[model samples]
Target: MLTSANLLLWAVLQLALLILLQEAFAWWIIAIYALLLLYSATAVLQKRSAASLKLANIVAALLTLALLLNMRQAGVLHFMLQILLLSAILRLFAMRHRHEARQLVWVQYFLIASCFILHQDMLLALVIMLLFGANCYSHYKLFAPAGARLNFTLTGRAVLIILPLWLGMFLLFPRLPPFWQIPNAKIASTGLSDSLDPGSIEQLVQDDRLAFRAEFSGTLPERQQLYWRSYLYEHFDGRTWQVHPQRRQQAVAPPTTAADVATASYRIIAEANQQRNLFALGMPYSSSQGVKIGSGGLIVADKVVSQRFSYSIESALAPLPLQSEREREMNLQLAAGNPKTSEFAAALRQQHNDTEQFIAALAAFFNQQDFYYSLTPPPLGRDSIDQFLFQTRSGFCGHYASATAVLLRHAGIPARVVGGYLGGDWHPQQGYLAVRQREAHAWVEYYSQGHWQHFDPTAAVAPERILQSLDMSLSDDERDMLIPFWQRSSVLQLLSLQLMHLDYYWSVWVLGFDDRSQQDLWRTLRQHIRLIAYSAVAIVLLLLAGMGLWLLHRRRLSKPLPAKQLLLKALKPALKNKAPAQSVSACLNELAKRYPNHAAMLQQLVQYYELAVYAGQPQAEHSLKRLLQQHKSSLAALNRAIKNT
Candidate 1:
């Protein structure tokens, strides 16, 4: 049985190895791992009984839980792996014999496997593959072949086969769609929501989650014009607003009048917000596949999307509503307790003959007054509109939109709130758009001149706020998380962006591959099966050829130079052909007395050969042959001299 102190020492060694594996530069992750390893090792070294080990394990588990809490936003796979690492550390403390030590190693394997779920990059995958080899070697060393002589070659071959098989299983196994929703390990939202309150916009500024991505087919929409409308909030609760409650499906009116209906089609690939709202650009005419567009013009997924989901929609900038009296009545309804605003609307209606002029006056009121667009808006009292307009002039998109809509009602104009993201990051290389949560905005649409007219009141206050990103407008303190110029230009960041594009495409084509994408894949495969098959075969052959070449290199490492090169004694040869001369130095010394000039040349040639071959420099093939031929005469003369002597 291993003594407690020795076991503790072993635990510390294993943990240091693990810390090195994590590549965590964070002193805390390293320090915590080191401290725990030391404590566990010390407990074992002290010969603490099983009870003490168990108690130590319990404390380790608690510490793991605490660390896990810190990584709550890291996702389920990350949290589990961290806990497994802690469990391994705890196991290290308890290891009394070889069996327990092996179990601790298995825990390490589990931790390593979980890393794939967090980072699936090619480099990380390769590192994990190597770690797998290391694991196999450790296992072989510990548990030799039973009753059979173990050889390095056979053991290595077994490991090579096993590792690929394991990787194949991981990649090929169909992960059954989760029957139940896994609790979002991240406490924060991944994308913008349909709902908007006072603090909604402010909170988004702190999050760095990707909201939606757009790949344009033709000329991209200008940043100023790219108002990708998502949700429509018709009903308000004096404080916050929500999309008019799930309404019953009704038949939509088909298009009648056709005028300037140029369609701007887009395929949106969005990460799930766990909300029902499936976002699309304004005036969506037609949609493809899984989405069911409601009569109220709200596009929703047939099922709640928990993973990345993709859908295509065609939108037109052309006007949608053509004078619906029923829709106008719905838009005009005022909330129950706004008597003062209602009275003001009656007076304004009687005073103004022109509705357009009255609307213009209200817009000018917002523009001319000291109203400001701010992410962090002050608390609004019970009379939300009054507090916003009179007391707290600083507000977000919601405040501007809400106050505008309420003012429109007071001026006897039918209006409602439109919620959506404003702009997207234009990737010049990938030619795609990435929309973030911080792009979430709210605007107003009034029923004017027989149609719903989009009017942005935020533009009235801060015109740039409607067009440009808030990051551009924020103070240095607010822009803390904004990627710095140097950081953005870094090689790593560029590489990361490229990888994200690849991942986005992977998600679009593979992860989010629904019935539609499957059909598309099937069609393509059917069209080019023979060519595809031949290409695949060629790729496999090339890979095999490379593998064979690598194996040959590994084997040839210990071999002697060609015999022809060995004969070259005087002429300076290519560096690759020169063999080690320390043992042969004595042989050269005897020849030096008879042919001292040739001895110096032979030594120089040998040195050059050693430097080229052993020092890892490239060797030219023809140069070696030329070297052998040039020294042929000198070598023969030397041989004759030796024989005669």
Candidate 2:
């Protein structure tokens, strides 16, 4: 039968594996793992023997094959994780003795550590810490005495002692890049994509999840100025808009001097979206490492952003450079549909010959017409732009931007729809702007005389959206669709905002603390080198003193106590008149007769004392101490009775 200690250790090991891999693995894999754990627990409870090596080998082989087949879909990282978890589980099923499970426990430790690769937020980090503690307990239980239970007090004390050392190492240690980059798993990309279709951005705007955060080095920009451009949709089919293939293949453009002095310098901390496209304002120039300056002043990561990424950028609010002949041609090409909208654009162009005046007229059309911004727009056919312009005037930002870009192109002006975020909630206390997926917006950038100018027809339709937030422009019903029912309460909204603030600080101080932060720490330490050295010396002395005291206490505990001395101390109350050299047996016999209440205990004590002193048995000394303790109150009563007499 398995010992209770072993069973407990087994349970902890399985729990650690589950908690670590639950988020990373497929649901079916996790369900299978849970079922196996249940089976193992049932066998342990029933006192049945562990699975035979043959059965374990069969399961291992099947799981290995399944993982290999899934490797392509899950990627190499998840495949390795699955294999590691499988080995650990199979090892447990095949083991009969606790000692045989030692290697499995170590594997669980590694699995728990690997969880940080996917999750680094504050809440998940705490969960990971608890998993570590559970794994540590399991490892300790492997060599501990049978039936030993976990001592929470000792565990907490150990954590308290080690926490400082952990912090010290984390702060002081030189941060080095990973020795080898782990392959990114196939995760669903989160934000905008290379193509924009009708209702695509409308669906995205309903999601309130955080996309990225920006920390400005200078004064915060105006609400209308925070248009974070991510992707440009140059090619327009009748129904969808996509990035031109040649645009992506073009080389990085040379930096151009800004026409205006207005610039915003900021650092962006973007959540992992599994794409190389990054967010920035107009005409961004970045020298940040691990990022590339793409054509048309676009920023892109050197690799897929499989984790949280940070980059610093300086963006000029001026117009972009003049479009190349190929770019103008690409942006001007339109599908052979929306002829009614084309005729309307051509007539408007005829009324205003100037490019700027034509653009103004297009914006005026959206403003003067009965256009309503709605997340749920009516579906359109092949002539989407024509229908949206005349029949279905209700649409989201994508509809407005698409119609405006199409109108501009029809009027012989090179224009494209820009996909990115619009307004962000600026937390003045935190000094950062939080941009969410709900802020996903689409606008237009038209190539005019010498430069490209940004235009948003949605702003002309609903100016409050640019002036404030999406909520301001939306009705209660539309706003409710974006926010959850639970968060509609005023109290819950305030609480949620506070939690976001806490998370922001955690991300900035902990997850965002990179090699540059370490270098800054080193520089600060060098400036106060003498103070740091003194503090270090003081800490070392204190640690040495604590160790010296602990060693002394241990030495005192290790020294053996003499049996004769212990007997004398135990019987001092009853031996007031006894001779100093009296035989222990005689003394016990006299005491047993005088205090009959403790006669049995006195006799047992004398026997143990003799065994300890003459037979030299260590266990006898322990027995003597225990016997004396059992009869302590009676012996005291005997002493008091003698005193009264």
Candidate 3:
């Protein structure tokens, strides 16, 4: 029968695997794994025998086939995870002897370590640590089968002993790149895509997940200046706006702009979005390693952002570069639909001949009209711009930006919709700006006065969105629809903000500690090398002195007591008269019998000797010394009397 310890080990193993691989596999696969775990736990609780070898092999074959069939969909990373977890479960199911269980525990250690590849959040790290402790306990109980329990004191002592070594290796060791590239799992990407449908950004508005964080080197920019551009949508199909094919194919090195004294310098710590596009403010002039400037001044990563990524950038809050003739032609091209809206745009253009005047007219039309900014907008028809402009007049940032871009194009101006995030929550105390999914916004960039100018028709209708946040601009009903119920209360909202702050610190200090950080640490150590050397020498000397003192004290404790030494010395005369093999008790007995008048005192001496030496009584030694000292002359006379007799 499997002991309770073995059952606990298996339980923790299954839980760790589930938490690690739940996002990698499909629901059905997870269901199968969970069901198998439940069945095994039930059997172990009821003290059922282990499955036969043949039955275990059959089940393993089935699981292997399932995993192989799902490999393509799960990708290489998740496929490996599934294979590891399946093997562990099968081993546990067939575990009978101590050796097999030992092998299973070792496999579990690898599985737990693999969890870091998928998750690196502080809370998840703590959970992984707990799982490690549980596995260690299980391993301990394997050998110590007599009612094994967790010994926190011993565990703590072991940790204390190993902590310095672990820290030294972590800090002083070289931070090398991975020997092999790990494949990213097939996970869904978050944040903005290259295309902008009418309701795409509206869907994002309901999701409050973090997108990225920006820490500035100097003072923070105005809330309205925080337009984080990621992608430019130039191709409009009357309903959806997407990037032109030429833009993707024609990625050239960004022209270096002279850095102004007031240039904004900052670092962005972006969450995994599984996409190549990155976010930046205004026009990025220069970026750190592993990132490049792509077409239209957009930032692109060297690889897919499959993990948390940090990069520094210097950007100039200036007008974008002039568009090429091909870009102008592509942005000005409008689809065949939206004819009514086209006529309206032409009439408005006829009133204002200048491009700036025409753009102002369009903004005034949106602000003056009975247009509503909402998360839940009505669906559009074949011509989404027409329906949103003339009929419905109610939509989100995507609708307004789309209609405005199309209107500018109809009026002979080259215009495109820019998809990215807008205002962020600036945390002054934390020294970073947190941009979430709800801030996902779209605006228009129109070519005017020899350069591309940033414009937001949505800002004309909802100025609060540019000045504050999405929640501030939204109504109570819209806010309710965007935010979850738990965040409605002030207490819960503050608690959530606090947790986010903590996660930000974890991302910066722990996950963000890379090669550059280590180099900086080494540089600092070198600068203070002399002081460190002196401190080390002083510490060594102090330790040696302490050890010498401890050894001397132990030697003193191991030696004979002073009272016993005195007793041995006083009995030398009497012992010389007795036979060599005779014990001190026999010599004392002879003296007591001969000195009958002083027999009580001699007898007392014998009792004291027996109690102090044989019985190991400390107080009896003091009594013996007192009696011997009080009757020193009498004892000597008794000794002489015994010698004469």
Candidate 4:
């Protein structure tokens, strides 16, 4: 019976944790839990007899196998969860002993430990509290009588007392890293990617998913200028752009000039995306811990970040003149086969004297011509740049930037596609800028004079996109508006920003504090060794004192009698000792002869005491006091009376 009860409890715990975590195997666990409930009901119908319960138990085990099959896609941790759940269900249905029950109890604990891997949110912590309380209640009920109506109340108090101790242990416990790495369940990837494909930023625009968080050391850049750079794509395949692996370059030292060093400084707290690209401002010169400088003056991770990561960077947004011939050549290289664009560029070069004049002329034409910024564009065929530039002047940032970069390259000017966010919404509460996926944009960076000069040709056609972002540039009826006005209203926007801050803390201080954090924590602890030692001694002393008090209180409460009742008990032994002879008649006769003055009182009291004693209600108080007062004479009389009788 105990075994069955324990198993039932264990199964319930597993079901609860699974539901709370919202694991991928939710349906399987639900089905198994239902099966167990059905089997339990059937056993109850058979009056809980062991032999009749076998069929129900067997069916439950089979359902467990079904559960495993259902959770095949959930990976190993989920598989273990299924196995343990099924074992608990089987144990409960076939339970016949206490040992099995104890095993089930440990199984429940193991299930809880598994929850730490699945989720570590605050809500899960509350659920664990309830499970722990239930465990204690079950143990209490095993020994407590059914009539003890205060059992729940007492159990609640015990749980309250136990909670702090358990928390203390939890907090002080040395958390070990996972024994072996478990296969990670796929979560959403955030931030930018190396390849820019269709539908890449489609769903991401609708996502409120956080990409990364930043904390500035000084004044922050305006939302319109919060262009966090990740990667630069130089290869274009007409419809999509890609970063070539072979062409990947490292960062070079910027020219040391007064104006060239102008930049903003800040720190970033980036979330894990299992990608190597790290976002910084315009041009970063230095980076914080764990970040590596890449060939393109970008920060690359030593490994794919699988946890929340933080880094600081120094960036310069100031313009610098192009100097290196190799850098310029690399930027200008485009796949050599578009005759129309090559011819158009040659014609434009004939009209302009220099590279600077060519760039200015192109920007002037885009501004004065029938160019219009539209999200939807007509399909471009083989000569995409030629079609976009000469015919369909109506295009989004992608079209404008791609055409501009190709034109500059054809004109013998070094240019590449710069991929990053164009603008952001400033969040007051978070003190940071929020750049969503829709803010994703591309522009041209061409080597001009002596350094790379950022040139946004889209600015000529859609100036508002550069000033307020694509989101704010579009009105309610506009096709390019990602968020409705009501959603982006200041009130709603403030609430979202606050939520982001909370998410930031949860990602950093809570969820992100892992093995490396533990090492830092231990280092800090070692520095304050005296404080830790004192706290340890104080806790031990407090525990010892509390135990002593509890023991004393228990010893006192176990006995019901008071001091008065104890005095009556003491008098019985004294009175029995005073009897001179074993014979009752002789003791009485001797008492009458030797102490005649007290004989009447003695006889009357003894008779009354005997009657009351036989009736099981001794008039203990008055009789006990009278016997004490006459003890000396009565004893002498009783000695003589014993011999005479």
Q: Which residue runs does candidate 2 get wrong by more than 4 Å?
A: 1-23, 44-49, 147-157, 534-645
Lowest summed lDDT over 10 consecutive residues: which window, candidate 4? 562-571
lDDT, candidates in the order shown: 0.66, 0.84, 0.85, 0.66
- Give one digit per residue, the lDDT tens place, for model 1 in 1-645: 444433544464456446544632234666777776776655555655543666776777677767766675556644555566767766765555678767766776766665554444445566766766666555554575544455879768987999899865544455565696544444333455656777776777666667878876777876766777767776666767776653343356653334565567778887767655777665677788788665445577876655567888777765457435666676666676555556655666676758777777767888998987666667877887777777778887778888888878767687888887888788878777988877777888888666677788877777776667767666566566555455556797778678778877676655665555556666887899999999999999999999999999987985555532453433223222335663343444545656775776566555555555556444532454465577777766765665565
Q: Considering lDDT, which of the candidate structures 2 and 3 is the better prediction for this target?
A: 3
lDDT score of model 4? 0.66
Best by TM-score: 3
Evaluated against the true structure, the overall lDDT of model 3 is 0.85
Native-referenced Cα lDDT, model 2: 0.84
Per-residue lDDT of model 4, residues 1-645, tens digit only? 343454456546655755754554566466756666566646645557433357746776686667667554666666677676666656666656666666766676676666666554445555787887676556554555654544567668987999999866544567876588766554335667777643344344545455666767677776545766777777766657788665565345553335645578776766567687877776677776688666556678776775667777877765545445666676767775667878878899999968788888889989999997765567777777777778876677767777888888888887887776666655556666555566667777888667777788977887887876675445455532556666667899777656666766666666656566667877998999999999999999999999999999999887633323333343333335554545443444455566677677556655645444444455653564566565756555544554564
Candidate 1 similarity to native, TM-score: 0.62
RMSD to the hidden true structure, all candidates:
11.5, 9.8, 6.1, 9.4
For model 3 the TM-score comes to 0.87
* Model 3 lDDT-worst window of ten: 253-262
User: Residue 246's C-alpha lDDT in candidate 2?
Assistant: 92
Two-way TM-score contest, 2 vs 4, winner:
2
Question: For candidate 2, what is the TM-score?
Answer: 0.81
